[model samples]
Target chain A: MWQEPRYQKETVRENPVEEVKKITFRPATDIYEMPDGFKLLLEMPSVDRETLKVYIKDNQLHIEGEKKKDVSDGKFLLQEIRDVAYERVFELGDDIDADSISARYEQGILEITLKKKEKEPVKEIKIQ
Target chain B: MYRPFPPFGSEFMKEFQQFREQLNELLKNVASGDVHLASDVMYPAVDVIEQDQQYVYVVELPGVKKEDVKLMVKDNSLVLEGERKEPEMGQDVQKIRGEIAYGKFQRTLPLPENADLDKIRAEYKNGVLLVHIDKKEETKPRLIDVQVQ
Candidate 1:
């Protein structure tokens, strides 16, 4: 006897909990290829150094940052800038060495460098 | 191979859709802005506020150096000039996507009579510039005393 599923055999259930994000924005980025490997530049204004994070996992690079709005109480005669979060990710290939990656954030621009691995020796073939 | 980064996750895609809607709103309000069709996205997004004692200006200039920015008052107007130099991209480098605006730009805004341009002060931090200007006492709206002769 099949227990507990005779009438609900094809029923599908989705996760009941999902957190709604308050605000979200995508930061602009520029990718460049260097002699050694690659360079990436991202613009994320007002994000604190401590709030920024960059890490690689499963050969994918992820960059995330958050900017908190000022809590000062004042009448906003003109409102334009607002606090928001930024996220960007990229896939890495084996040609680049992930262990040698380095990054720096300054003036709201994050720069990341990924060094490439040494090329393997080539074997010559002679045609008869 | 160089390629524009795709939406890495569903969260990114959802955010991108919302951002696109907001951009469309901006596009619809073309009359309020000097938006050039050729160059829609520009640098140094600014906000101006008028307070009782002063006027405030906030500008966003990411990746720009302080020395590169120039602020001045000319003909009773506030003038801002700056240049964002492009990072050297070698021949082997291929462009994936470019959204940030670069190169020199100039913006001039007319000031009100109450603005004391000479008393302006500016501070730059976290790639944002905040400018404060004291209000001119003479131009402040006030009631004059009247006496009977």
Candidate 2:
């Protein structure tokens, strides 16, 4: 029980070092395919909307942010968990138009909308 | 002092109504998650045992690295503090949903009088922290035998 706090401290101190390493975060995401686009829902706790960064990179979508600590100074009767920085990535499909992707964060959830690319016209074929 | 219609009875009643509304608002704030407390954190299961001349404590902290944890026996209390860092995100992150919990946390437990101050050893393996404490020699119980006719 006591070591839980130590775990939290080390995580905070080593965050800068982790940035250079390859790490994977398991974030629950829901994807919905519609006629016009795809909708994605992401959950992130203790993260401020302004601190989150979402973008597409090399056919993959990336989400990263730093969650600020909620602990106050000069007092503590008990503590068990701490909020830390997080980053997540997702692969985009070929049909998705990268240029038309949009995202919104509200109530600790991130919702992303990706429009599908328009299909090219097909010419009629005649057989002799 | 029995005058002025009970000191503006209607006015006093209006103020009392407003006070009740404010009290309800305060209760709402207290019930919300916005209030942060140590109890709000997820606590790993733990068990402590005392046998013969030693005290043993086992803490289960799955999905947490040993290096990220800190254990300290201070004064008459055992303080445990650590943070569970969120894993890095991959290149493609469409959306995020359902965050259970990831962050810094601390828990402190008071030690009993019979607890040994010295001869303490701690080991962490398989996401469990085991601390062995040897009680003071003077505190150990002595077996006594009596022969009856």
Top TM-score prediction, candidate number: 1
- Residue ranges of candidate 1 with Cα displaced over 4 Å: A1-21, A68-73, A122-128, B1-41, B50-53, B90-92, B110-112, B137-149
lDDT of 2 at A99: 96
Per-model chain B TM-scores are 0.61, 0.59
lDDT of 1 by residue, B1-149 (tens): 99877767998889989999988866753322212233434557776777778888777788889999999999998899988887777587876556567888777767778898779999987778788888888745778889879
* Model 2 misplaced regions, further than 4 Å: A1-25, B1-149
lDDT of each: 0.70, 0.59
Q: Each candidate's TM vs. the true structure?
A: 0.66, 0.39
Worst 10 residues of 1 chain A by lDDT: A1-10
Q: Over the stretch A1-128, how does candidate 2's per-residue lDDT look in tens digits?
A: 00011112112223564453322233345565567777766545445456689898778888776554332232222333334455556667788899998987654456788888998889888986
Model 1, CA-based lDDT = 0.70
